[model samples]
Target: MGDIENIDNLLALEALLQVTFHNRSLLLRAITHHSCCSETALRDSYDTLEFLGDAIISAHVVEYIYRSFPNASEGDMTALKSEVVSRRVFALIGQQLGLFPFIRVDIANLRTFNERSRDSLCADVLEALVGAIHIDQGAEVARDFVARAILPMVEQVSVQADTNPKGRLQKIILQRTGSLPRYRVLEQSGRNNDRIFLVGVYDQETLLGLGKASSIKEAGRLAAREALETLQKQRGKASIIDVGDESQPQL
Candidate 1:
C-alpha cells in the first residue's frame, strides 16, 4: 500500500482499537517495519516502539493479574505473564486484529518466507502499536486496551494449572510406578518453513498413547494427555473388576 493509504488504514485500525494518539507520527512508526523502509531512510521504523511496548505489555499484564488474583503468588503471576506474552499468543492476537492484511512488506524480499514466518511482522506491529498507545495515551489506555483485547481471551490459566499433563504424568508415574514416562518421536514431517511432529507416550516400554501437532512440545503434551486418560480408564475398570471379584460366584 502507498504511504497515504497506509496511514489511512492505520487510522481506521486506531479507531477499531478505540485509541486516539496525541502523536500520530509514533503510531505510523509503530506500523512501519524496517522491511518497509530502507536503512538510509530518514523515517523511523517500529523496532524501537516494539521494544518499548514489550515492557509496557508485560507490566500491564502483571499489574492486572496481581490485582485480579490477589491470592495468587508471585510465581503464579509470572507463569501467567509468560504464557500471555509468548510469541504464539501475540501472533494469535495479531491475526485476530487482522493486522496481516494491512501490513506493507515488499513481496520481492518476502518470497522466501512462509505465512507463519511473515506473521512475526504482524506481531512486531502489535507491540509497536502498544508502545505507541502507551507513549501517546498513557498507561491507563494501554492497560484498558490490553484488558479489552487480550485479557478476556486468556481463559486457560486455570486449565493450564490443573492439566499440565507433562508434569502431572511424570509425577504420577514416578511416584506410583517408580519410573518416569518416556516420550518417543514417532514422526516428523512438513515444509521447512512449518514443521509438524507426532510423538508417542510410553510407560515402562508399553506404548500408552500418541499425539500429533505443529510443534514437538505441543505434540508431547498431547501424548501425555492421552496417556493420562488411558491410565484413568484402566484404573476405573480395575476398580469395577475388583468389586466384582469380591462378590460370591454363582453356582
Candidate 2:
C-alpha cells in the first residue's frame, strides 16, 4: 500500500491504540518515516521521538523485570531484559497492533518488510507512538500503552529463557568461551513474502553451525541449536572442539 494523502485520517488508529492524541499532529508525525518526508518538508519524522521512546521503553522494561521477578537473580534479570527488551519484540508488537497499515512510508520501501529484520521500521513507529503519547498524554498514559502493548511479551520471554535454542545456546557459549555467538544471514531465496533465510552461527572466528528457515530469527534458533548439539557431541567425544587457524568470515 501507498502512503496516505492526509494525516488527520487517524481516528480508526486512535481507536485501535486506545489513545486519542489531543495534538493529532504529534501522532501523525509519529508514524511518518523519513523516506516519505523530504528536506524541505515542514513536518518532522519519527526519528527524534524514536530516540526518546527507546529510553522510555528500556527503563519501563527494566523496572518491570525488577518488580515482577523478585526471586530472579540479578544475572537472570539482566539477561532477560537485555535479550528480550529489543527492537524485534517491539516490531512484533507493532505488527500485532496492526500499526503497519497506518505508517507513512514510501510505497517502494513497503515490501522490504517482508524479509525478516532484527531492527525494523515498525519498531520505530511503535516507539515514536510511545513518545508521542508521553508528550501529549504524559508518563502515566505512555506506561499504560506499554503495559497493554508490551508487558505481555515479558512473561513469554521469561518462560522461554531456558527453552529457546538461541537463549540457551547464548548462555552456554558465554559460560564456555566467554564470547557470545553472532548470527549472520548467509543466504536468501523464494518469492515475495515467502522468502527463506539461511543464517550461520559463529563463535568469534569459528563457524559453529548453520540453519535455514522462513525468517532470520528462526534460522538463528536452528543454528544455535545445531551449535549446541555440536558442542555437546564434541564434548562427549572429546574435551574441546578444535578451531584450526583460518581467516575469519566477515559478517
Best by TM-score: 1
Candidate 1 at residue 88, lDDT?
Answer: 70
Q: Output the TM-score of candidate 1.
A: 0.80
Over 8-81, each residue of candidate 1 has an lDDT whose tens digit, in order, gives 88788788778977877777778776766877324678888899988888887777778887997776667677
Error of 2 at 58 (Å): 0.8
Question: Which regions of candidate 2 are displaced past 4 Å?
Answer: 1-8, 40-43, 109-113, 116-119, 162-167, 170-197, 200-210, 213-218, 225-251
lDDT of 1: 0.79
Error of 2 at 39 (Å): 1.0
lDDT of each: 0.79, 0.81
Positional deviation of 15 in candidate 1, in angstroms?
Answer: 1.9
Model 1 alpha-carbon drift over 4 Å, by segment: 38-43, 73-75, 159-164, 228-251
lDDT of 2: 0.81
Extract clashing residue pairs from model 1. Answer: none
